[model samples]
Target: MPTTALQDQLERGVAALGLALPAGAVQRLLDYRALLERWNAAYNLTAVRDPAEQVTRHLLDSLAILPYVQGDTLADLGTGPGLPGIPLAIAAPGRQVLLVDSNGKKVRFLREAIRALKLEGVQAVQSRVEDVPGQFDCITARAFASLADMLAWGGRLLAPRGVWLAMKGQAPDEELPGVPAGFAVRAVHALAVPGLAARRHLVVLGRDTA
Candidate 1:
């Protein structure tokens, strides 16, 4: 698809999501997508190939959870090619975003994207999720792992009052029972991503105070 069409699709999707992004966020998002596409050709960053599909499955799909995102610090665990992390940073500029992944190639692409897009507060770290230190007010895991395992590995990074946003294709009802102790399901939202029809859900979890 042409760049203009992709922009149109992204704009409509953002509007449908009821998000009013920064003035140039839409264009910057497209630029990020282009970078991902180019890198994916050589490094195989993501499974999705087509550019239009990238907008639907990657860009809009990531932006779908924007409304639920909170706090000034966000850590995207298993951020392969910076899925929701990069898009979220583009849409919400001021928040500090940390994209973590063990894959060196993916991290390299993420760094290039951050620099090319001039995303000031974003940083890419090539490391396992468990070893990434520091607490974040919001944490995103995009189809990275089962809820049980994700919490077991990176749960420590979530602030006492922070939220964990787990993006999944379907509601992980079976995994709810396996959520490790000290964390509870706050809510589960069915995301409606534009230009694509697929089951998408965001499982919100928080530290269990009681």
Candidate 2:
């Protein structure tokens, strides 16, 4: 499919899920994706190369967790090619998004995408999840780490009343018990990504009690 057509289709798909995205931002996302595909051949930044899959799997998967993201300032850990973070920023232009990843190459790709898209309210930073500076209202991870490790190494990055939105497959049943005492796990809602083979869950983790 042509890039413009695919872009329109993506907007329709997202709207079908009750999420409305701005037309210019959708076009920017499509342009960014096109650039990403071209760069992926040499950068090896992402495993997902197919254009259609990029929409349903990567883009949609990210937006599906939008409601769960609790703050104006958000951090996306292990944000390879800015999965949920970039897409989320595109969808919600008002939210400030920091895309953090340890891999220098992936961070480079993210920087390039940000410039290419001329995206507002987006920043790319290179750092480990644990050592990343500043606090965030919400932190997101996709195929980044086990829930246990996220709470361990990355938990401190969240603001005092922040939430953690994790996109994972199969619900991660065995991992819930290991969260730190302050953090509690709740609301495992299935995601509705089209053409996705595995079951997706938007796992919500948070700590509001002192």
Candidate 3:
């Protein structure tokens, strides 16, 4: 399929999800896809090559969690190639998003993507999740680690009453037992990525009241 078809599909997909993005958001997403493809050749940023598949797997797959996202500040931990972080940032221009990753090359790509995309209120930082400074109202991790380990490394970064959105292939039943103290699994949402056949789930975690 042509790039225009993919863009049209994306626009329809976002609309189907009942999310209203800004005027140029879809264009930015397409631009981001192109940048990812261009950089992937040299940096090995992602294994998926077909642009149409990327639209579904990479772009829409990340955008699936758009409705569940909350708050003004978000940190996408281990944001390799800026998956949901870049897409989410493009959708919500007013929100402050920080893409945190320890890999130098990935962070470099993220920086260049941010620059080329002209994504405002976004930054790419090179740091381990545990070492990242400050707090954010929302944090996202895409198969970066087990739910337990992800919180262990970055739980402190979640502000009081903040939420952690962990994207997974399926319900992480076993990892629930290993959740560290001071946190609770708020909810588990089964996400349906437009045009994606595989299962997708988002585990919501927040500070424990007890």
Question: Cα-based RMSD of the predictions, in order?
Answer: 0.7, 1.5, 0.9
lDDT (0 to 1) per candidate: 0.94, 0.83, 0.91
Stronger candidate by TM-score (1 vs 2): 1
User: Which is the leading candidate under TM-score?
Assistant: 1
Q: lDDT per residue, candidate 3, 1-210, as tens digits?
A: 787898889998897778899998999999999999998999999999999889998989899998888999999999999988999998878889999999999999999998888888999999988789999999999989998899888999999989999999978888898999999999988988888889999999999998
Question: Each prediction's TM-score against the native?
Answer: 0.98, 0.94, 0.97
> After superposition, which runs of candidate 3 have C-alpha atoms over 4 Å from their true positions?
none
Off by over 4 Å in 2: 208-210
Model 3 residue 44 CA deviation in Å: 0.4
Model 2 C-alpha lDDT per residue in residues 107-147, reported as the tens digit of each score: 89999898878877899988988788888898999988888
The model with the greater TM-score, 1 or 3, is: 1
lDDT, candidate 3, residue 92? 77
Model 1 agreement with the true structure over 11-123: per-residue lDDT tens digits: 99899989999999999999989988889889998899999999999999999999999999999999999989999999888999999999999999999999899999999
Ten-residue region with minimum lDDT total, candidate 2: 16-25
The per-candidate count of clashes, in order, stands at 0, 0, 0
Looking at candidate 1, the ten consecutive residues that score lowest on lDDT are: 189-198
